[model samples]
Target chain A: MEQLKKAIRERGKVLSDEVLKVDTFLNHQVDTHLMAEVGKEFALRFKEDGITKVLTIESSGIAPSFMAATDLGVPLIFARKKKSLTLTDNLLVSQVYSFTKQQTNDISVSKDFLTEDDRVLIIDDFLANGQAAFGLIDIVKQAGAHVSGIGIVIEKSFQPGRVKLDEQGYRVESLARLHSLEDGKVTFLDETVSVQS
Target chain B: MEQLKKAIRERGKVLSDEVLKVDTFLNHQVDTHLMAEVGKEFALRFKEDGITKVLTIESSGIAPSFMAATDLGVPLIFARKKKSLTLTDNLLVSQVYSFTKQQTNDISVSKDFLTEDDRVLIIDDFLANGQAAFGLIDIVKQAGAHVSGIGIVIEKSFQPGRVKLDEQGYRVESLARLHSLEDGKVTFLDETVSVQS
Candidate 1:
């Protein structure tokens, strides 16, 4: 978590409107070492939950999900942004609107992958607006799977992501929480958590 | 490679138009343990290439790229399917047409992540038409980066992927190259590879 926070401080670029570009480590270009640390934190946070699978949206969330799923020794199901020829006809589909892209996208997982017997841990890179996480949770719920927990690497608490999920009764844990990005300066919720920098 | 090959044979379903769906392991639903094996194999294969970064297209390619990049201790940069707010004006863009989606998508990478001094190895989950790989190579070339090699987990040799890349003088390596899928029986070009089932 310290490594991630350090990476965020050093490599993260605070754009206008609370957009933090961490292409150097988190989303576009992944830092496997920091991700491992984040994965360990997620596992520690949800070790007793008996997570059956790790669910995430396409692209950005796949890396952290990979590390967490591996640590939990569970399969990670990523909802594809576009429906490929490979996906099954029987699926749990949810519509998610990405404010970043300014478009509505359908995210889905096969009905065969998630079942009532399964408990899912949803993971992602950033929790902004909580649209992607909610979409994944919808898919899990469609299959009658229990939402064991939601793990995030970096969360923008100033946004309504955490508040929204909390209202939905989902336990959310984020390693790094940003309080504000006013005037291009990143202020952490808990600066003491900045151990690696 | 054996594990991937087994996953392809066991869980991989052959559709009407030569689509091999291995959603259970490599793509939609990822097996983290199997992905670790894939990462290890890619590390062994490209260890001598002095790869500074691992590149791939978005979605399915992100998972294998994570495994390979983590094992190699390198940065993994995936060309996004579309431009998001996180993307900057400084980018290297390439046009890729997906036959499955029946649409042409532009793949772009931020210029800051890749440099002329960087040695890149492109990794992807499948190699069918080679359009996406070509797009990734074009982006890398546009950034003046050197593509050390191309690593694919599965190659449908029944297609023109290898031929096009071979003509382009790129080093393309596939862990499992399919020879045929006649009568629903999937056969590999290499004997050392065995299906898990």
Candidate 2:
């Protein structure tokens, strides 16, 4: 978490006081070493939950989520984004709205992978509006599986996402918590204050 | 490679004579342990290439690609697909046609990631038509970087992809080579015959 926060300060591009572009290392061009550390931390945090599977949405989340799954020795199920409106009986679908992209995508996972017997850990690159998390939660519930915990690489704490998930009784673990991205400055959340949440 | 061949024999679902789906492990729902093995194999195969970067496309390719980059002690750069035709000056773009999706996607990578001095190892989940590989190759060339080698999780040997890459003088190492998927059976290419290629 310390290294991630340091990387954000050094390499993260803060745009328009609201957008943080970590395309350099965190997402687009990934530093596998940092991601491995991230996976180790997430696995250490959620290993006690007896996680049978790690769930994540495709593209950006796959790197860290796959690493976490590797450390946990579990299978990783990545939800795919569908361009078409087609629905099948064998799949569980949910709509996720990305604030960054300003678009809604249909994310889905096959029902064959998840079951009531699985304990899932949902992992994602960022937790902004909780839209993606809610969508993944919907798919997990549709398959009758329980999400034991949620692991996030970056959390925009200035946003209402973490509060929303906490209100729903879901425990969220984020590696780097952003206090604010206001005025083109990267600010991190004080851990002592946020650990209670 | 033996385990990968066995996985293809056991868990792979043959959709048609040409289409083989390993969504159970290779993609979609991923087996991280197997992917870790895949990463180790790719790293071992390309260790002598002096690879500075491991290139892959978004979604399915990220898991094994990230692991390969991790083991190789290099960075993994994933090219993102753009739905819109808008191109930026600072990005390198290429068009990739997905044979399975029946769609053409514009895949782009940031210009800041790759440089003329870098040696890239291109990794992908499948090499059916070599469309994605070609697109990635374009981006690597645009960056003035050299592609040292290509690594594939599964290669559809019945297809002309390998021949095309070989003809282009690119060394390709595939973990599992499929001879054919005809008659609803997964047949692997004999190593003795394929090693000559």
Candidate 3:
């Protein structure tokens, strides 16, 4: 977790007050070493839970989810952003709105992948508005599978994402939590202070 | 490699004479263990190339590239299918036509990721018509990076992908080569026979 915070400070670029670009290492171009550590952190957090599969959205979520799924020794299922010729009607579909793209996309997973017997851990690159995570959770429920926990790489705590997930009674764990990105300076939430507070 | 061949024979679904779906373990719902083996196989193949980075397209290519980059102890960079808010004018873009999707899409990689000093190994899930690989190779050339080798999980030998790359003088290594997918049955090229022939 400390390593993640350090990477954010050293390499993360603040484009605007509302947008923080860690594309240098996190999303566009990935640091597989740091990603392995992030996966280990998630695996350690949810080691006791009987996670059958790791679920994520397309594009950004695949790397972290791939690492976590590999570390956890479970298969990973990522929802597709666009419907392909291979993806048939046997799917659990959910609509997600992306503020960055300002477009709503339908995300779906094959019904053959998830079942009631499976326990899923949802992982993603970032948690901003929580729309993507919420959409994944909705698909998991539609498959009759159990949501074991949610693992996030970076979270914007000042946003309502964490609070919304908390209200939904889902256990959420993030490697790095951003308190603010005000005045082109990124501030991370101090775990000790937050725990005490 | 034998494991991949066996997986293909068992779980691979032949939807038609031209379409073979391995989504059960390769793309949509991924088996991380198999993917790790794939990464190790690629690492072994290109162990001496001094690859500074691994490159691929978004979505399906991320998993295999993640594994290969981790094993090689390098960073992984994937080209975005569409330009996002984070991606600015600093990019090397290429247009790719997807035969399956029946549309052409622009793929771009951030200029910050690749450089002239970098030696890159390109990895992808499948090698069909080689349009995606050609696009990636073009981007790598645009950035003045050297292409060490190209790694593919499955190569449809009946298709022109392998031959086109061969004509272009790019070294390509595929884990499994499909001889034919006829009558709803997939047949892999026999390594010994092909080498002898």
Give the top-scoring candidate (lDDT). 3
Instruction: Kindly give the stretch of ten consecutive residues in candidate 2 chain B with the minimal lDDT sum.
Output: B81-90
Q: CA lDDT of B21 in candidate 2?
A: 76
Fnat for candidate 2 (0 to 1):
0.91
Interface RMSD of the predictions, in order shown?
Answer: 1.3, 3.3, 0.9
- Where model 3 places Cα greater than 4 Å from the true spot, the runs are A191-197, B191-197
**Fraction of native contacts under 8 Å reproduced by each candidate:** 0.92, 0.91, 0.92
Error of 3 at A116 (Å): 0.7
lDDT per residue as tens, model 1, B40-139: 7888899999999999888888878787888789888888887877685898999999888888988899998899999999999889999999999999
The prediction achieving the highest TM-score against the true structure is 3
**Model 2 ranges with Cα > 4 A deviation:** A83-89, A191-197, B83-89, B191-197
lDDT string, candidate 2, A18-135, tens digits: 6788887778899999989998899999988999999998888988887789889999999988732222458899999877677888999988999999999999998988999999
Q: Could you tell which candidate, 1 or 3, scores higher by TM-score?
A: 3
Provide the interface RMSD of candidate 3 in angstroms, 1 decimal place. 0.9
Give the per-residue lDDT of model 3 (tens digit) for B1-197.
Answer: 89999999999999988888989998899999898899889988998999999999988888877878998999999999998888878999999999998999999999989999999999999998999999999999999999999999999988999999999999999999998888999889884355554
TM-score of each: 0.94, 0.94, 0.97
Q: Estimate how well candidate 3 is docked, as a DockQ score.
A: 0.87
